[model samples]
Every structure is written in structure tokens, then in C-alpha cells.
Target: MIPIAKPYLTAEDAQAAYDTILTGWITQGPRVQEFEEKFAAYTGAKYAVAVSNCTTALHLSMIVAGIGEGDEVICPSMSYIATANSIKYVGATPVFAEVNQEYNLDPTDVEKRINSNTKAILLVHQIGMPADIDAIKKICSRYNLKLIEDAACAVGSAYKGQKIGSHSELVCFSFHPRKIISTGDGGMITTSRKDYYDRLRLLRQHGMSINDRVRHNSKKVIFEDHIEVGYNYRMTDIQASVGIKQLEKLDWIVTERRKIANKYHEALKNIEGIRLPLERERYFSNYQSYSIYLEKSFPINRNRFMQELLDNEIATRRGIMNSHRETAYKHLEDKVNLPVSEKLQDRSVLLPLYVPMIEEDVKFIIDTILKLTQLKTV
Candidate 1:
């Protein structure tokens, strides 16, 4: 069956992992540092800290941003649960906000939700589509609020002329298999601030006063101290080895994904009651997931459509979920009224999209979707 998303990995990536493992430095050491430096250079960030996963990256970002108990972080509910969970990890309340047509946080709605308790705006570049950064930054500037970016699916995406991670102060990214790049499962946080960089490095490795690499390379024996309480969130050298290779092929992978997305746009744009994803002017997306919004006038409901695709050997998934509607966040169900977020979650469908997909499979999937979505008329 055609999968919803897949990483563009190669034999070289495997070889990198194998080579790194053979070196006996299998933990967070030189390889992790190299990956961090390369990633920071790629995204134009002054520094980057590798972590176990995006959730840990977000947790660290929240901590460095000074979000804590009684503080409210404004974020879109239409995102992975981890987005909201990170705020809670640092003892901050997540104030769910609405999203615009681009599926990113709506700055206008964000402003309306702001109160004296609001501390920061956690903006997500949903599905690699860059949000209105300038617009959101303006709002943050006006209110003296901090802006942290959830760029899990936006590693290669650009907002205006700069990359997604480079545009924000504290941007977190994922290297999950479902993303354009893969390190089995890992994450990174990019920041320009030296203080944030130093603290993040310390926090990811149990708040040690000196990192492992520093001590290992030193000629004299040195003792370390736990400066503060921190989590074991460091990314392994095994993952970093793979990540370094994956990062090298990221631009090519994004190009291939965009090609597949363009084919989908061309084939499905004529269909009524189907709203395709959009890339606004100067906003470059990696097209991590190609989701189509099904309007009420659509020929079939989202569930049935996905089932049909599954039957046809083409896997599909529901759109980005609303964390507020989940059992874990049931308390927020009655407190928020996000019509757009709810509608998009229920009606949108994610089509199969991956790099290096065969032409025959791509055509077959497109043909099946077109046939299934044929407009009905008198």
C-alpha cells in the first residue's frame, strides 16, 4: 500500500550509522556535535542543540524561554499533542488558538486570546507551511511577548527568504521518519541567543557543568558538577550519524516531494468541494504532508474516502488533530470554541506523499482519488 509519508533514506545513511557505531563513540559525542553544527549552518541559526525527540526539544525551548507556572503559552490546538504537552511540561498553561487557511496559527485570533497571564506565542509551521512570521512577529513585538516556533515538519521550509528555524528565536525541529529527514527519531532546537544555547546544552545532558566531549578531550583529569536539575534528552551519536547523512540530501528530498505535490495539485484542483493546500507568496514549504480539505459539498465524508483509498491500496490519514478534543485534554473541551480548527480536523484528508515514489503508483493513486471524488449532478 502507498504510505502517507516516508523518509528519503539511502545506503549511505545506513553506512554512516554503521561507521559511527564501529567507532565505539555510540553516545552523544563528536557525531552529535557535528550534526548540531551542520544543522545550525543549514538553518542559519547561530546554535543548535540535539535532543532525543521533538517533545524534549519543545520542553527545553519552553524552559529556556522562561515559561513556567501560571504562565499561558498561546498555541494552535490544531497540532500534534506534543505541542501543547510541552507547555504543560514546564508548568505553563496552553491557551489554544485558531489557525488560518494556511493551517498555521492565526495571529488575529492569537491576539484575542492574549491576557495579562500570556507569556509567549508558540507558533507552529504546520505541515511545513511557513506561517505568517512577519505578521506574528509584529504582534509579539507590540505586546512584548516571546515567540517560539514548532518547526517539526519544517526543516527545509522557508518563510520569505529565510529558513523556518532561522526566522524565530527558539525553533524546534523533528527528524522523525515521517518527516523529510530521519534519524530514527530525534529532534533539534535552533537559537541565536548564546545564553539559551549554553543552557540547552547543559539541560539536555543532566545539567552537567561540562559535557562529555570536553572532559574526554582534556589532557588533565576533571570533575563535573550538576549545576541544576535537567533531563536526559541528548541525541545519540548513532542517530546523529544518520541525521548528518539525511541532512545532506534534504534539499533534494524536498524538491522531489514538491514535484509529487504539484502533480496532486494539477490532478485534483478541478475537483469541486476539495480545497488543496496553499503556499503563499514568498513562503516555501517542504510539503511534509499533502492534506486536502473536504467541504460539505464533497461527494463523500472524510472517513469513507479514507476507507475507500485504503481498500484501493492507497493509505490515507486524517488531518492534523485538535489536542483539546482528546481524552487527555478533556477539560479544555468546553472552554474553547475553535470552529475552523474543528472543521479542518474532521473534514481534511492526508494523501500519500513521499520522495522517489514511482510514476505508476503516483498516477494510480491520483486516478483512484479522482474516480472516487467524481462530482455528482442532476
Candidate 2:
């Protein structure tokens, strides 16, 4: 069966891992530092901290931003549960907000949620589609709130002419296998501020005054100090090595994905009850996920529609989650009105999208969907 998403790994990626493993400095070391520097350079950020995954990146970002108990972090209800969970990790409450048609936070809704307890606007660039950064930034400025970008699926995406990481004070990216690039299960946080950068670096390494890299490079046996409580969220050198190679091919992968996305867009545009994902003005998405919203006008319900796709040997998945509806977050349920987010949670589906897919595969997926949707009209 055609699967939903897969990594574009190659012999080079495996070789990178092998070579790094052979070096015996397999934990967070030179390769991690090198990967951090290279990623920062690529994304136009002053600093990048390589971590275990984006969830930890978000958690650390919240801690450094001084979000603590009684603090309310305004975030969209429509996102991976990790986004909300990260806030909860820092003892802060996640205030669910409305999302726009693009499945991003509505800036006006964000404005309404702001009060003295509000600490930051944790905006997500959902499914690689760039949110209205300018509008969100203005709101953050007006309310004196910190703006943190959850760029987990937005590595190659851009806002206006600038890349997503470069525009935000704190931006978290995932290197999951499902993302545009994969480092197995890793993440990176980018920031222009040296203070935030240093804190992230220290926190990822057990709040040490001196890190392993510095200790290894030092000519003398220098002891380290535990400055504060910190988590062991460091990314391994083996993963970082793979990430470096993956980063080299990132642009090519994105270009290929976009080519396939365009074909899907053209093939599916005229179908009834199908609402395609949007690339808003001045935004450049890498199309990490090619998701579509099936309106209630459709003859088949979401479950049956997915079953049909599965029977056709095509894999599919539900769209971005409504974290508030989760059993773990029962307290947050029905606490806010997020119409667009709720509608999407029930109706949207994610098609297979990855670097390995070519034009023919995309065409096949599109054609199959067309035939299914056309059956009712017949």
C-alpha cells in the first residue's frame, strides 16, 4: 500500500551515521555543534540548539521565556498535542484559540484572549502553511507578549520574503521522518538573541556551566558546574550527522514535493465538496503535508471516505488535531469556540506526500480521489 509519509534517506545518510558512530563521540558532541551551526546558517538564525525533538524545544523555549504557573500561553486549538503539552510541561496553561482557513491561529482571536496572565503567543505554522506573522507580531507587540513559532512542519516554508525561523524570536522545528527533512527523531530551536541561544544551549545539556563540547576541546581537565536544573534533551551526534546530509538535500526535496503538490492542486481543484489547502499571499510552503478538507456536502462520511482510499491501496491520515478535545485535556474541552478548527478536525484528510513520490504517484492518488468523489454525481 502507498504510505502517507516517509523519509528521503539515502546511502549518504547511513554513511554519515556510520562515520559518526565510528568516531566514538556518538553523543552530543562536535557533530551536534556543527549541525547546530549549519542549521542556523541555513535558516538565517543567529543560533540553533539541537535537541531530542521539537516538543522539548518548545518546552525549553517556554521555560527560558519565563512562563511558569498561572501563566496562560495563547496557542491554536488545531495543532499536534505536543504544542499544548509543551506549555503544560512548563506549568503554564494553554489557552485554546481559533484558527483561520489555513489552519493557523486567528490573530484577532489571539488579541481577544490576551490579559495580564498571558505570557506568549505560541503560533504554529500549521502543515507547512505560514501563518500571518505580521498580524501576529503586531498583536504581540501591542500586548507585550512573546511570540514563539511552532515551525515543526515548516522547515522550508517562508513568511513574506523571509524564512519562518528568521522572522520569529523563538522558532521550533521538528526533524521527524514525516517532516520535509528527517534526523530520525530530532529537533532544533532557532533564535536571533544570544541570551535565549545561550540559555537553550545550557538547558539542553543539564544546565552545565560548561558543555561536553567545551570540555572535550579544552586542553586541561576542566570541571563543570551545574548552574540550574535542566533536562537532558541533547541530540546525538549520529542523528546530527544524518541531519547534516539531509539538510544538504532539503531544497531539492522541497522542490520535488512542490512539483507533485501543483499536480494534485490542478487535478483536484474542480472536484465538488473538496476544499484544497491554500498558499496565502507572500507565503512559500514546502507542502510537507498535502491535506484537503472534505465538506459536509460530500456523500460519504470521513471514515468511509478513508476506507475507500485504503481499499484503493492508498494510505491517508486525519488532518491537524484539536488538542482541546483530547481526553488528557478534558479541562480544556468546550472552554473556547474554535469553529474552523473543529470542522477541520472532523473533515480533513492528509494524502501521501514525501520526497520519494513523483509526478505519476501524485497523479494516481489524485485520479483515484476524483473517481471516488465523482461516484455520487453519477
Candidate 3:
């Protein structure tokens, strides 16, 4: 069966891994530093901190931003649970907010959620489609709130002529195999602020004044100190080696995926009771995930539709998630109604858009969906 998502790895990627292993410095050493530099240069970020994964990246973003206990961070519930969990990692409350037609955090709803205790807005570029960054940035500036971007699936995505990482103050990215880029399981935090860049660098490596690589490279014996309590969230040279290669292919991957996305749009646009993902003007999505929304008027239910796709040998997945409905965030749930977010979680399906899918694969998936939607076609 066709997969909903898969990593686009080449023999070169495997070779990079092997080369790093041969170097005998597989920890967060030269390769990790090199990957950080390349990623920062690519994203226009002044510095990029490589980490274990996106969740840890988010956690670090929160810590460096001064989000802590008694503070509330506004984020859309229609996202990966990691988005909300990151806020909690800093002992900050995550207040659920609604999303717009673009499936991004709605600025209007976010404004209403902002109380005296609100510290930041964790905006997500959900599934590689950028959120309304301008509107949200305006809100942050007006209220003096921190703006952190959960850019997990948006490695190669852009917004308003700028890349997603360069647009936000603190942007967290994922390199999970399921994401646009694969580092096996790695993440990066991009920021233009020198202060944040320094703090994150110190915090990610156990808050040590001197890093292991620096100590080992010293001609004479050197001492180190733990400046503050920090987590072991460093990315390995092995993962960074693979990430470097993945980064090289990012632009081409995005171009090819956009072509596939266009095909899906063309094939599915005419179907009744369906809502398609939108690319806002100047917001270039990488289509990290191609999710389809079955309107209430659609003939089939979401589960049954997915089942039918599986029966037809096409694998599909549900939309991101609704954190409020999950047991993990039960205490965070509130009376505030997130209608758009709820509807999106319940009605959306993620179709296979992995690299290497042929035109025939795209057509087959489209034809099946059209049939499921009860549209007439040959």
C-alpha cells in the first residue's frame, strides 16, 4: 500500500552517515557545528542550534524566551501534541485557540485569549502552510508578547518572500523521517537574536561553560563549569551528517512536491463537499503533508473514507490532532470553543505525498478520492 508519508533518502545520505561514523567523532562535534552553520545560512538565521528533535527544540525555544510557570502561551489545538507539550515543558500554560481556513492559528482568537498572564504565541506553520505571520507578529508587537514558530514540517517552506525560519524570532524545525527533511530524528532552532542564540547554545549542551568538543581540542588541560541547569538535547554528528545532505536537496524536494500538490488540487477541486488546502498570497507551502478536508455535506464519514482508501491499497492518516480532546491535556481544556480546529481534526485526511510517487500513483489516489466523494468520472 502507498504510504501517507516517507523519507526521501538517497545513497548519498547513507554515505554521509558512514563518513561521519568513520570520523570517530559521532557526538555533537564538528559535523553538528557544520550542519548548524549551513542550516542557519540557508534559513537566514544568525544561528541555528541543532537538537535531538523538534519537541526538544520547542522546549528550548520556550526556555530561552522566558516562558515559565504562571505564564500562558497561546497555540492552536489543531496541531501535533508536541506543540502544546512544549509549552508545558517550560511550566507555562497552553491556552487553546482556533485556526483560520488555512489551518493556522487565528490572530483574532489569539488576541482574545491574551490576558495579563499570556507570555507568547506558539504559531505553527501547520503541515508546511505558513500561518498569517504578519497579523500574529502585529499582535505580538502590540502586546509585547514573544512569538515562537513551531516550524516542524516547514524546513523548505516560505512566507511573504522570506523563509519560515527567518520570519519568526524563535522557530523550531523537525528533521524526522516523516518531515520534509530527514536527519533520522533531529531538530533545529533558528533565531536572529544573538542573545537567544547564545543562551540556546549554552542550554542545549547541559549549560556547561565549555563544551566537550572545545575541551578535547584544547592543547592544554581545560576545566568546565555548569552555568545553569540544562537538558541533554544535543544532536549527534551522525544525524547532522545526514541533515547536511538533506538540506542540499531541500529546494528540489519542495519544487517536486509543489508539482504533486498542484496535481492533487487539479484532480480534487471539482469534487463536491470538499475543502482544499489554500496557499495564501506570497505564502509558499512545501506541502509537507497533503491533508484533505471532507465537508459535513460529504457522502462518507472520515473513518469509513480512510478505510475505503486502505481497501484500495492507499494508506491515509487523520489530520494533526485536537489537544483538547486528548487525555494528556484534559486539565488544559477550557470552555473556549475552537470550532474551526475541532472540525478540521474530525474531518481531515492526510494522503500519500512522499517523494518518488509517479504520475500514475497521483492519478490513482485522486481517482479513488473522487469516486469516494461521489463525483462522476471515467
Candidate 4:
């Protein structure tokens, strides 16, 4: 069956990994530092810290931002659990906020949820499409709230000509196999604040005053003390080797994904009872996952449509989970009604999308969807 997502790796990545292994500096070393520097340059951020995964990156961001017990982090209900899990990791409450049709946090709803307990707004660029960050940033600025961008799906995405990671005080990225870029399993945090950058660097490596890489290169064999409690979330040099190669091809990979998205948009635009993904003006999406919403009038329910696609050798996925409904967060009082988020959860489905997928594959998926829609009308 066709997979919902796939990672594109070439010999370049393999060679880089081999070189790192031969050097015997596999743990967080020169390669990791190089990856961080390259990633920061690509996103135009002053600093980037590589970690084990996006979850850890988010957790580090929270710790650096001083979000802790009793502090409420406003986040969209419709997002991957990692976004909410990070808040819990820091002993903070994640307050649910409504989403717009774009499946992004509604700035208006976010503003209403802001209270004295609220410390930050954690916004996800869902499915590679950018959130209404300009408006969200305004809300954060007005209330002096810290803005954390869970940009796991938006590696090459941009808003108003600025990269996604550049806008927020702290932005988290993922390089999972299914993501636009892959380093096996890794994450990075980008920020302009020097203190936050330093804090993240320290927090990712067990709060060590000096990292092992620095000590290894030093003539002295003396070790350092732990400054604060931190986790062992450092990314290995081997993984960073792969990441450096992936970074080189990021733009080309994003271009291919966009081409596939455009093909879907062109083919599905005329189909009735289907809402295609939207590309807001001045925004550029990586199209990491091509998601479409089945309209209420569509004769076939989302589950049935997904099943049919799967039966026809096409794979699909439900949209990101509603964090408020998860067992972890159910106990918290959900004061806000996220109608849009709930509706999206029911109707949204992700289509097969990745680099190297031929044009014919896109057409085939579109045709299958259109045929299914037509059959339901009979």
C-alpha cells in the first residue's frame, strides 16, 4: 500500500554518517555544532540548539522561558500531543484554545483565554501550514506573553517573508523520518535571545556547565559541575552528520513537496463537497502533509472515505489529535468550546505526500477522491 509519508535519503547522508562513525566522535561533537550553526543560518535565527527530538526541544524552551507549575500555556486544541506534553513536562497547565478553518490557533479565542495565570502562547504550524502568527504575536505582545512556536511540521515554511523560526522567541523543529527533513530522529530549537540559547544548551545536556565535546578538545582532563537539573536530550554527532546533509537539500525537497501540493490543489479545486488546503498570501508552506477537510454535505463520512482510499492502495491519516480530549488533559477544566477544532478533528484527513512522489501518483489520488465523491452522490 502507498504510505502516508516517507523520508528521502541519498548516499550523501550515508557517507556523512560513515565519516562521523570513523572519526569515533559519534556523541554530540563537531557535527552537532555544525548542524546547529547551519540550521540557524538557514532560518535566520541567531542561535539553534539541536536536541533528541521536538518534544525535548519544546520542554527545553519551556524551562528556559520559566513556565512551570500553575502557569497556563495557551495552545490550540487541534495539535499533536507533543505540544501539550511539553507543557506538562514543565509542570504547567496547557489551556485549550479554538482553531480556525486553517487548523491554526484562533487569535481572537486565544486573547479571550489569556489570564493572569497564562505565561505563554504555544502555537503550532499545523501540517506545515503556518498559523496566524502575526495576529498571535500581537496578542502575545499586548499581554507580554512569551510566544513559543511548535514548528515541527514547518521546517521550510515562512510567514510574511520571514522564516517561521525567526518570528517566535523560541521555535521547535523536528527531523523525524516523516518530516520534510530526516536525521533518523532529532529536533532543534531556534532563538534570538542569547540567554535562552545558553540555557537551552545547558538544559539539553544534563545541566552540565561544560559539554563533553568542549572538554574532549581541551588539554585538561578536569570535569565540570551541574548548574541546574536538566535532561540528557543531546543529539549525537552521528545523527547531526545526517542532519547536515539533509539541510543541504532542504530547499529542493520543499520545492518537490510544493509541486505535489499544487498538483492536488489544481485537481481537487473543482471537486464539490471538498475543501482543499489554503495557501495564505505572503506565507510559504512546506506542504509536509497535504490535509483536506470533507465538507458536511459530503455524502461519505471521513472514516468511510479513508477506508476506501486505503482499500485502493492509498494511505491516509486523521488530523492531529485534540489535546483537550486526551486522557492526560481531560481532568483540566476545558473552559473554552473549541468548536472548529472538534469539527476539524472529525473531517480532516491527510493525503499521501512526500518528495520523489511522481506527478501521476498525485493525479491518481485526486481521481480516486473525486470518484469516491461522485459515487456518494448517487
Please list the C-alpha lDDT of all candidates, in the order they appear. 0.93, 0.91, 0.91, 0.91
Runs in model 2 with CA error above 4 Å?
none
| Best-fitting candidate, scored by lDDT | 1
- Give per-residue lDDT, candidate 1, residue 341: 96
Q: How many backbone clashes does candidate 3 have?
A: 0
Off by over 4 Å in 3: 332-334, 375-378
Deviation from truth (RMSD, Å), model 3: 2.0
lDDT of 4 by residue, 151-248 (tens): 99999999999888898789999999989999999999999999999989998988999888788879978789999988999999999999999999
Candidate closer to the true structure by TM-score (higher is better), 1 or 3: 1
The C-alpha RMSD of each candidate to the native structure, in angstroms, is 1.3, 1.3, 2.0, 1.3
- Tens digits of per-residue lDDT, candidate 2, 1-378, equal 889989999999999999999999999999998999999998988889999999999999998888999999999989999999999998999999999888999988889989999999999999999999999999989989999999999998888888879998799999999899999999999999999999999999899999887888899989999999989999999999999999999889989989888888998898888999999788999998988998877767777788899998999998788998888887767576787898998999999988778667777888888778766621
Clashes of each: 0, 0, 0, 0
TM-score per prediction, in order, is 0.98, 0.98, 0.97, 0.97
Question: Which runs of model 4 end up more than 4 angstroms from their true locations?
Answer: 332-336
- Model 2 / residue 292 / CA error / Å: 0.6
